[model samples]
Target: MTDCIVVGGGLIGMLSARMLHDQGLDVTLLDRQEPGQEASWAGGGILSPLYPWRFPDPVTHLASLTQAAFPSFADELLQETGEDPQWTQNGLLVLDPGQWDVAQAWARRWPDVQLEALDQPAVHGCEPALAEGFDQGVWMPRVAQVRNPRLMRALQHSLVRRGVDIRPRTPVSGFRVRSGRVTGVITEQGELLAERVVVAGGAWTGGLLLSLGAPPIEPVRGQMILFRGPPGLLSRMVLNDDQYIIPRRDGHVLAGSSLERVGFDKSITEAAAQTFREAAARLVPALADLPIEKHWAGLRPGSPQGIPYIGPHPEVEGLFVNAGHYRNGVVMSIGACRLLTDLIMGHAPICDPSPYRIDRADFSVRRSNAN
Candidate 1:
């Protein structure tokens, strides 16, 4: 029998499968489509919380731990899968109207981070493409990024090589519950019996849970755009207001993103596309001349009180959940998976999992109540 059956083959699910496989568990990863082709691929690749100070402690703490894991994780993925998950430490430049006290307040709050105020000339010297006459900006030297899509690919390849049975195009319909404990899952193809089952279905996690008579979760759609530009166009990732611009070493500029509660609608809009282009142009005028390589959207899983729904399900035994990562899914994957793994093994997690537990009151609110 498979020791663990992990549903949802995205970053979180794949990571959970890998960790379990490492512990010598018989693991099988099932997904509706190819793994890592969802929100994990359609992301800005910003490894840091764009506005950490604005978020609560749980989000900040988990994100920080996951951010610290990227450097070494990237190297491990490359060595194991022969895929270079380009981890870039180019930092982030946050620009806003100098008149806004919120931005300045946040800059001051994060003293541990190198938040330097940059003037118009200083910004221009750093990137000639920036719009002139900006009042002030904050430069976070510790901010970093990873090529998210590449990392997902590496994880999938590595998991399979490590003896994980990955089933792409396998949609899980619901779970097999016996006497309040989950026995296995009922997929579109067939039934899978396992000792334990984990749900990492991303945006669709809540619906999947409801089908199993489990609690609810919701999906928030995040739209993004990608542009192809010449190399050296940008030396760092940048954010201003609701927009962010991420550049690749290979001359591709990822401009994003807009958050919408449009309910699982992963379709791009002309207005959103225009908004992104305008925002990118405002940040770096040269982006206006670059050709857009792609425009797409992905549904991000969001939980109530804005914390990730990670850990065991309260009402069910032998079933677990690790979704609702919203925006920071890529950054929070490792730390979140580590906590979940520890919980599954009946061992105490090094970091407190209470903040991200599925049974938390915040997650059990109306937001988590709704399917």
Candidate 2:
């Protein structure tokens, strides 16, 4: 029996498995498809929250913890894999603070976070290409970004190098439960018993839950477009009302992300692409003529309350959940992994995991009664 069986090899799954293995646990990771191709890779790689106030307290705490982990985590990944994840501390600019007051309010709620106001010339000084804006914006100096694809590949390689039983293309059919405790997981090939299981299956988590007689986790579709623009189009990440621009070192710009309620449809629509293009051009007019590099979509697992399920279930022992990160899966992986690790190891977590427990009384999985 493997010490731990981690389902879904995305950022959360991979990190959980790695942390467990580092602690001398025999860990195995199972995934339906190649590990990072899901929401983890599909993310824009912005390491900070787009706005502080949009997230609730739990999310704010999680994001704050994860942001602190990026610098060291990026360095560690590079040292282990001999590849720089291209993490840049370029800070984020809230283009219009007046319109961003809701976010400002959220930031104010959290005294632990640092938010500074930036003047027009300061924003221009940081990112020269930003179009002349009406007023000042908020500057999150510690905000950063990463080349997510590079980080994904590096993490996969790093995990493999550390002797993790990384199994790709392994589809888990369901969980094997008896007397309220999970025995193991049943896969398409065969059954593998483990002492514990952690489900980190990003968008597909809801379906996995259904197989085990659990509640629903809806998938929200997010579409984004990539652009190959001239180097130095925007120095730091620029946010304007509904859109933002993230420039990479290699002259590739990641202009994106529209929140759509289309369930599981990964197809890129003309409307979504135009929406991103128009938004990008509004922020940086030069993007109006930039070559469109790629257009794609991915599903983000969203819970009813927007907070992820990151602890053990009340109905099932030895089974833990770590999904429902929504738009912040990449940003929250560090804390999510830490919280899951603590729950599995029976140690006190750095922060209370009660709010994010899988079986919160109010959000418990409803059972069917024979009428």
Candidate 3:
């Protein structure tokens, strides 16, 4: 019997499994599709949320913790796997001067986060590729990004080296619960008994939890487009309005994304592609001539008020959750993993887990025995 079974293979699940293994637990990670091919692979890899002030306190807290730990985390991964995840601290430029005041307030609240007000010339100097815009912006010099695909690959490699039972393409059918305690998981192959189970199923987490009378998680589809442009054309991430353009170490630029409520549809619509293209071109005119490299969509796990469920199930013993991260899974993965591991191992939590508790009063998951 495995000591723990993590029932999702995305960033959250994989990180959770790694942490559990580090704690000397017998861990097995099961995924329906290949691990990390879901939202974890599709995100733009921004280390910080687009607008920190706009989110709830819980979101900001987790993001801040992860952002601080990212450099060391990426370095450790690179040293272990010999694969560079390219942790770039090129900064983030918010082109909307209208949000300057709110951004300043948030920065003040967290003195550690560096925020600078910039004039038109400064914005242009920071990113000359940007289209001729009317003046002012905000610069967050402390903001960073990672090459998510590489990061995922490094984590998978490290986990494999650590002897984790990383089971890809293994779909979990249901949970084996007896007297309110989860005894094991029922997968397509067979029953795997475990003392504890964590549902890190991303967008599918809600449905899995709903089977055991938990709150349903909604899938928010985001479509993104990639552009191959001249290398060194853009130095930093540019955010204007609600759209963003992220530059990789190479000449590749990622422009995204359209948040659609259409359930589980990974189809890339022409309209979304056009919207992304227009946004990219508007942000950096040179991108207009650049070749369209790729277009795809991913499902983000959506929950109430943009906060995720990260604690144990209210009613189900031996069950835990680390899902509903929505678009911030990459940003929150490390902190979430640490917190979840602490809870499962009965150690003092790294942060107060009250904000991310599954049984918050405002949001309640419906309980049912019917599968």
As for candidate 1, its clashing pairs are 206-217
For each candidate in the order shown, give its overall lDDT on alpha carbons.
0.82, 0.82, 0.89
Candidate 2 lDDT over residue span 81-188, tens digit each: 998889998878777757446655766777666677777787677677766763687777778899878989999999989999988999999998888899889998
* TM-score list, all predictions: 0.93, 0.94, 0.97
Model 1 lDDT tens row, 1-371: 58999999888999999998887789999999989998888777888777666777787777777888889999999999999989989888877665335655765655555667788777666566678766677777788888888989899889978878999999988889999988999987889999999999999887787744444457788888889989998887888886899989898999888878888788889998899999999889889998998999998887665678778888789999988888888878888898889899877884888877655354455354564
Candidate 3 regions exceeding 4 Å error are: 360-371
TM-score of candidate 3 relative to the true fold? 0.97
Mind giving the per-residue lDDT tens digits that candidate 3 earns over 1-371? 99999999999999999999999999999999999999999999999988888899888888888998999999999999998889999999999868888988888888788988899898898888888964999899989999888999999998999999989888988999999999999988999999999999999987786766565578999999899887898999989889999999898999998789999888989999999899888888889888898999999998887788888988789999999998899998898889999999999998999988977332342542342
Supply the global lDDT for candidate 2: 0.82
Worst 10 residues of 3 by lDDT: 362-371
Winner by TM-score? 3
How big is the positional error of residue 139 in model 1, measured in Å on the Cα after superposition? Answer: 0.9
The better-scoring model by lDDT among 2 and 3 is 3
Off by over 4 Å in 2: 97-105, 108-112, 360-371
TM-score order, best first, reads 3, 2, 1
Q: What are the RMSDs of all candidates, in order?
A: 2.5, 2.1, 1.7
- Candidate 1 off by > 4 Å: 98-112, 211-216, 360-371
